[model samples]
Target: MSDADTARRALALLDLTDLADVATADGARDLCRRAVSGPVPVAAVCLWPRFVAVARQALGDSPVRIATVVNFPEGDTPIAPAIRETEEALEAGADEIDFVLPWRAVLAGQLTTAGAMIRNVKMRCGDKLLKVILESGEYPDLDKVRVASELAIAAGADFIKTSTGKTARSASIPAARAMLGVIGMTARPIGLKPSGGIRTLADAKSYLALADAMMGPDWATPATFRFGASGLYTALIEEIGGAAPGAPPRGSY
Candidate 1:
């Protein structure tokens, strides 16, 4: 495909994210406005939980979904609070929940806690999409990464994401390959979201190509695949034709 075609496809799979600590209502509104203003709108807008309502209101019936994080960059919180956060985000009109997997517990051999957390949140998530972030860079090895992926999928995550973007080593090709391997083995319909440090079109294409090689060409649609990124949007914008008007500064997460 030409660069423009590749970019258009990438744009459709993007989750234009703004999870910065300083992110405000005006920022969320601005993101929402810019997201839909483009010729091809992105799949969703991923942001802090508190801004879900603002994004939802700003989007105002556009196809762009609202996604918010819970147990966020730190996944140490117990299940109850995470569930409460999920409930509140849903109430605030978030269409998707990206919850940080309790990787600390998983690494410590508290596998059951990780599974239980996912199950509890899955119950509350109901039909809404639930993305479980493994924070892959923290895992010492690929085997642990696959183990975490299985636990999340078994516990009912609609998508298994690679990172929270706050970690020094957020997303990587090897880690994404392992996650995609796990997803390909499952009969259930699960998705892959390789987030963090995916800035350029080439970076986005690497993840997209790996998904095609591992899963199947038809598998990585907006429903089955997404790029959890902020910097990528501007790159896609450039690829599509022009830069977004009033583009927000891209952040690490």
Candidate 2:
């Protein structure tokens, strides 16, 4: 298969409705329904741990996967609590969990400590997919982005995401490239999420391009890439030549 074909397949496997920042159950359901109803086959509805049940219940028998956030934007939680949060979310019907790696842990230069925390959470969840949020937009340099991605992958994340949409800046091509480089060099079959500020088809397509450019054609598929956004898909759908109904704009954190 060609690079474009591989990238297209990867795009199809993505959980495009990553409204993880949606703060309420009703809002989550609305986005979940919007996600499921769209022309694209969204892999999942990503949300806060508090609403995993709401999304799972709302999605019912649909093919969409149910995912929830762990420590969220800050990634400041203690390890024990973070692990507990993962378990709670799993019990609530989350098939995937995205954890924000502790910025303090990474900043204090406790990279291994952060990885170990993620490892424990992965252990607790077993086969459930885990996407570790690097929150690259807040880091001091691209090296931090590189280090964190390696740490998260080493810590056992099934994927390494670029940001928490709660941050002022979200995923960028530089950050995505930094993460993908490490994953490719290691030949680690992990996922990537270029999330946060992505709001239009252009933003999504650019990130998709970054995936192809950075990870090469073969690994750019949906199984390896995701977009974490609040109101991105609606505009993306419209831009992609579809008359898909829109989701209400994100109102709060």
Candidate 3:
């Protein structure tokens, strides 16, 4: 595909994010505005749970969905608190819940603990989309990545995300391949989200191309795939030949 075509495709699949520690209501509003101002609307505006209502009001009936994080950056939040966070975010109008899976539990061979958290949070999510952050980069290898992916899927994650972007490493192609391989084997529909450090159209194309290769060319609709990014939106807009909006402060994806 041409750069313009790739940009448009990535734009539609983007989860325009603002998880910065310093994020404010004004910042959330600006993110919402950018989400809809582009050539095509992003799939969602991902923000801190506190700003879900702010984003909802800013978007005001726009087709763009609202996404918020829980147990974010760090996945160690206990199940009870995570559930409460999910409940609160849902009540505040979030359309999707991106929960950071307790990957440390997975690494410690406590798969049951990780799985329980996903299952409990998913129960609260109900019909809402639940994207579990595997924090794949923290795993020792791709094999561990696949293990976490399977656990998340079996535990009822609608999507398995690559990272929280808070660690020394974030999304990587090997980690993504492992996650996608697991997703492909499932009879149930599950999605993949490659977040963090994906800041260019070329970066977006690499993942899109990989998805097409592994899952078939028609597999990556917004519901099935997403690029969790902030800086990437500007690169996509530039590729689409428009004056890009002011880039927002960088945030961990």
lDDT of each: 0.90, 0.76, 0.92
List the candidates' TM-scores in order. 0.98, 0.89, 0.98
Query: Tens-digit lDDT track for model 2 on 74-138?
Result: 78988898989999999999999888898778977987788789999999879989999888988
Per-residue lDDT for 82-183 in model 3, tens only? 999999999999999999999998999999888988999999999999999999988888889999999999999999999987788899998888899999
Which prediction has the highest lDDT against the true structure? 3
The local distance difference test score of model 1 is: 0.90
Winning candidate number (TM-score): 3
In model 3, the runs with Cα more than 4 Å from the true position are none
Tell how far residue 129 is off in model 2, in angstroms.
0.7
Give the range where candidate 1 is weakest over 10 consecutive residues by summed lDDT. Answer: 244-253
Residue 185 displacement in candidate 2 (angstroms): 1.1
> Which candidate model has the greater TM-score, 1 or 2?
1
The regions of model 2 sitting more than 4 angstroms off are 1-22, 251-253
Q: Which ten residues in a row have the lowest lDDT in candidate 3?
A: 244-253
Pick by lDDT: 1 or 3, better one: 3
